[model samples]
Target chain A: MMLDNTWFVEKSYFEKFAMAWKVRKKLHSEQSKFQKIEVLQTESVGKLLLLDGKTMVSEIDEFVYHEVMAHIPYMVARKCEKVLIIGGGDGGVVREFVKHKDIKQIDLVEIDERVIEVSKEFFPECTQGLDDPRVNILAEDGIAFIKSKTNEYDVIIIDSTDPEDFASGLFTSEFYKNVSNALTEEGIMMNQTENPFLDEWGVGKIYKNMRAQFPHVQSFTAPMLIYPGVFWTFGFSSKKYQGTQLNPDKIRHMQSLERSLKWYNTEWHKGAFALSNFHKKKIGL
Target chain B: MMLDNTWFVEKSYFEKFAMAWKVRKKLHSEQSKFQKIEVLQTESVGKLLLLDGKTMVSEIDEFVYHEVMAHIPYMVARKCEKVLIIGGGDGGVVREFVKHKDIKQIDLVEIDERVIEVSKEFFPECTQGLDDPRVNILAEDGIAFIKSKTNEYDVIIIDSTDPEDFASGLFTSEFYKNVSNALTEEGIMMNQTENPFLDEWGVGKIYKNMRAQFPHVQSFTAPMLIYPGVFWTFGFSSKKYQGTQLNPDKIRHMQSLERSLKWYNTEWHKGAFALSNFHKKKIGL
Candidate 1:
């Protein structure tokens, strides 16, 4: 469940550092069964969706996070048809997936239904694909939902909150095993690993455990301007494909189909894997 | 001169967004002739030097900023000697210069002397090369210092504070032309350009102005974890060579000389110039 948030100064103590945003107005606030949610109009970053006092998505820089989360796996996988997105109630991840014409189905499993409602009202551009005929919105626990399915989804995107509250089980070794079991032979899973800058978050521990569960595991980083730690990381685990080996033809073709993108591109896709030496030492790569 | 700072939450209103760090202790504070200077021990980011209420350098992640500022120019330029560092009284930029064995002379012109003394006392690692035999520390205004030199330095690093307060003259076209006159025919200049995320900073305006003063101009970005905006930019203006053209053999030989580095590498060196589409559009590149 989301934590209660203060209205004026949204301060988050990420490790020893405190990141704050000046709020113009509190658009909405309510306590749902699953978590507390708040929508805020900020002076600079436009609208913000805070789940448990944590910035889930902001209107200004959401594209950088969502694009890498969705497009990196899609462009790498030979064929991405049936997709599964967990905890992305804001619909940003789903919107990125709907850009591909070949994707037949997308199942968005969000634990809280209220997040979807608020995002639909506030972030219309981010939630554009929520009403697609091929999309299904399932209100349930993502960990339990993935446990129920086996070898069904072609691509799995774990766009969940930090693994501290309701999403704690999603970061465990057993849940990763279940995620490995739930994917098809050629499927790849993309999970939002926390920032390494905050050592208390134990991102390296989760990455090490994921490596034990999957045949191929790698991590990539991108800058998320509003996130507690601006340099954010993502965990990419694959069953049959190496995340680094990209089919340039496929990426070019995808670029042709979905022409305009703000952040992700062919060069950035390749460069994302070139982990900085500082990060290499931090993650023990 | 440095500015007085609050010892609790060091709040900075960057554009419409606010970035803050929790201060553990105020190590030192004084008013220099030019600006206000404060040395702060932050909870997360170690020893921070604030000039005119702006972050000049922080101990924890200062390497990221200084390394890129110095190494990018050194690695790209065919041969870097007789270096000029303007406004880097903290000696972080000079420390990077000392790593290159070929650099014969380093002329450090700093407007404020207290910053150097504070840095030597608090950030010894960053100020290591301040006492090197090759270094000549000039206690004078950087804008006036550069105007007096003509075709004298091989590399010019404008490691000044933001183009505000005492360093406001560094960002003007006339100052850039003076900087151009102070460099050799094959000289290259690296200046700290502010983030585009903060529209009030006018990084695009500075980039356009620099383009008029130099034959070739390009801007590259890197994540400065403790800066106001994490995705920070640096402007690279050249006279004779493209900034991206690197002598790999020279870098390899330099790596043999200076072995351990936290951020800069051959891959990252090239990737740093790979412009993000979002940034390209913002800067009208």
Candidate 2:
């Protein structure tokens, strides 16, 4: 038999045996907020959130979730000077948003103070720009915060978790209406919807509701390794801006920001909007 | 704190929790060839094989590896009649190859009788045509079997595992030389090289070596969920065919094969070749 003591095959078997040792251990913790959150070794791809145990951004290769959530609105809004971020306690979103030097003020509404504290401690690299004077961190409910606000912000990003307990309101039609009310006439809103691979129906529902409130609704997908599914889909809605009218110049400007990015690049910005034929057919894009 | 007990968030949380269960327990399996291969569930997403076992087709999403390994050869050789698939015991590649009615015969050389045995037992839908008269199954080492063959095969697919143990010989330039010698003058060869996300260096090295022997050498990437890294890449080399010269009629004919595929649609066929500008520059596409 060809399988007789082949050195290469045997070495592979040995390597597989050794990998069992390298697999990281996972730890689960229940917060004072009664949230059951689990933390694990960042592993080969995910990064350890140095500041907080409650939240961690997977490594740069998995930054599609953050990049799309931030860039889409920044690209759509013609003049996004004042922005509001809801529940992005990790500060990665703020870091991407501040890239637009024109962003004079940023209001980050995070309900859990612990997520910010944990992120500040564990994910220093991702949260480095949190101290920027333009950012005002508000530990409050995002829905309530948006409801009280007038048409003051140029862009609003709902960077909340999956539509679970505390995050459920973020997915509601009422929340979307409130978001529409909170944005200026030309404002654009983007939300971290969920894993389309598993929750296509849920994502479709969100897209439909957002369409009802906003004149233009678009959904885009990106790969996220840390998420339950391989791909995470996000939805964007605007009264004035259309997704197809993506300003190439603004995207090029964003691409020139760091000169070095492992994941998001110019081609990706355009390609990310190019959905699978199935999705395109479904969304009528 | 807006996170107060909300039913919508609760429902979303349960849905996400249930998806986690499905991924950990039902969708993905931890069993290996040395251990035990189990089918936690069975579902079809076109002509693709969704094996839950770690070894059968180590990756659940085999489109990336299978598509490049299958399409490149068919694209290169304008007219391919006799095709040989070695070690794709799961029948995914065979399903792709059978798309062209012009393929007169497909000889599947697989050593681990257990692979085909298990595939037949669990992946009945994908393996539906294994018993077709045009297919010849050789329960033997692919290397030995290929060395004994003459210039009869028009396309040879080495659908083996990683270049670690049993699959080590398959990766050697020597095995490729054998493949080159076994093919007809106009024949082509394709193989699942490695995970580009984890082994770009290794893939680059293999691509370099393949370029030495074949007049044409190219590599393409596709997304596969079950691989060590989420994305997988495959290398294609041939003495006579170019991937860009895909005959429109031939592709249309291939699509006519009633094997419904979730990922490999005509648009995907076009998009698969649409490399990222960065990758295109790297590969000199």
> What TM-score should be assigned to candidate 1?
0.93
Error of 1 at A282 (Å): 1.4
The CAPRI category of model 2 is incorrect
Q: In candidate 2 chain B, what residue range of length 10 has the lowest lDDT sum?
A: B5-14
Q: Which residue pairs collide, candidate 1? A: A2-A35, A3-A52, B1-B35, B1-B36, B2-B35, B2-B36, B2-B37, B3-B36, B3-B37
Ten-residue stretch with the least lDDT total in model 1 chain A: A1-10
TM-score (all chains, Cα) for each model? 0.93, 0.74
Over the stretch A1-285, how does candidate 1's per-residue lDDT look in tens digits? 011132234444443565566677889999999888998898768898888777889998999888889988998888789999988999999988888878999999999999999999999999998998899999999999988889988899999887787888988999988888889998899998877765656887888888889988888777787887577888889998877777565866766644488887767777677666777767667
Task: Evaluate all candidate structures by whole-model CA lDDT and list the values in order.
Answer: 0.81, 0.62
Which ranges in model 1 have alpha carbons more than 4 Å from their true place? Answer: A1-7, A10-15, A257-259, B1-7, B10-15, B254-259
Candidate 2 lDDT score at position A100:
77
